[model samples]
Target: MLRVAAVKSPKIKKIENSPPASPPPSPVQLARAEENRIIALAKLHQSRTQGLFVNVGPSWMKVLEPEIKKEYFQSLCKFIASERSKHTIYPPTDEVFSWTRMCTLNEVRLLILIQFLFFSVGLCFSVKPGVQRPPSLANMYQELSKDIPEFKSPDHGCLTGWASQGVLLLNACLTVRASQANSHKDKGWEKLTDAVIKWLNSNRSGLVFILWGAYAQKKGSFIDQKKHCVLKGVHPSPLSAHRGFFGCHHFSKCNDYLVQQNKKPIDWNMLPAELMKENINIQN
Candidate 1:
């Protein structure tokens, strides 16, 4: 057997140029990227300027014009920043003033307009000094429960239940100086709140107003009585809850009005299941 020797041909190796070095980004491309970044920042500023913060929920914001919203947000931030520099403010500058949690602002059927919110309490209606007296809010809750038997009391200090039931707990003067009531009064909150009430009155119908104090009643006075229901009572503070707030069947009457208006009555008894356990734990 003869073995044939095979001659291997010299293979030419082709050197491939590396992917053209990805052509260093053109000046135009870089400029475009910078422009995009500027545009993105501008959008973010516009959102904040338009009061798109979650705490300033869209429901209320939608009622006011965008210009009004922008002015209000900027002015409020300016005032808060200035006041905070001088002394301690009740609601820290960082926290958004709304105490509401589960509210879907568009769905709100009732408005609870208050004069001024308490300072840093977390729970807006949680009255203090439990040993000396029962929490006035709790007393009011009892009255509500008496009328709507299934109404779950916010014993856990969470207003999620009330908020979920479409009750908006709004304060006219959202900020106050610590230990000094009405310190922030006439600082433009009046104008903003007035606008909100007037807007709602004109645009929406079949809504209910629970004006708990003289101030709140006065604020809601312009509300069209024929188109909506207005329930006025003394302030629910321990000092005044006894005078008229106790006997006023506002809860039941609110539902009655809703029924008459052909709108679904709020299930005052409905509370989220998750919050139920939280309520129990807080009690224990």
Candidate 2:
């Protein structure tokens, strides 16, 4: 038996008082950690989904410090937010799929530009990725060209073919709410719209701008009339279709302009083929 020290050593006192090293996170703690991981992954997937055509937030969000990452994640989530998630507005990372406004090797003269307020329907992507247009917009596309005037979920191939052949579907506001009612009302939208218009107007000309309705027509004001063909009319909404939209003969007129410009007319029929039959690329 060791003799008791007149006074306990400071070392012994420290050891006894320090308290047992906190046990490794409890089973409960481990479970909570796993749950957090799952949540993080889900949030990332949502961001990527909303991004469309481009892999925006998900891929890189992991590397940022927690605070900064939260900022962007919250921003991107705003467009897709439900009543619970809406917060600060953030710029979108993806674009609706399309070729550059200035495409070369086109079998045509210049791109036919169709302007919209914003993407009325969210762009859908899959392993075989593509965009899904709203019903009215789809009808507008069919009216422009094609025999069958309908498709369920339009694919990327349709858009790719149009871009490849010679069409630029430009939206005045590039990003909008997932909800249609308040779609492009946010303050950031017009700033984005101005940038896109400026880009199109800069170092480009002779583009055919199809400005349907008052809003799209207004968006075209900055585009030089000397450089582009501004085809304006009532919008393609069911409400406005009767207001000089039906039988406006825009498709034929667009082709006519292209032909007059000495550039090959776009194969409007191509989109119909690609949209209805996903496996095929639209040709002639």
User: In angstroms, how far off is 7's CA in candidate 1?
Assistant: 72
Ten residues in sequence with the least summed lDDT for candidate 1: 275-284
| Model 2: per-residue Cα lDDT over 134-222, one tens digit each | 55555565465442333233433245445445455445444444445435454243444455455556545666777777766776778
RMSD of 1: 12.1
lDDT of 2 at 241: 74
Candidate 1 local lDDT, residue 182: 77
Best by lDDT: 1
Runs with alpha carbons beyond 4 Å of true place in candidate 1: 1-55, 65-75, 92-101, 121-134, 152-154, 271-284
Residue 227 local lDDT, model 1: 86
Query: Relative to the unseen true structure, what is the C-alpha lDDT of residue 47 in candidate 1, on a scale of 0 to 100?
Result: 65
> Candidate 1 at 62: error in angstroms?
2.9
lDDT of predicted model 2: 0.47
Clashes of each: 0, 1
Q: Name the TM-score of candidate 1.
A: 0.68
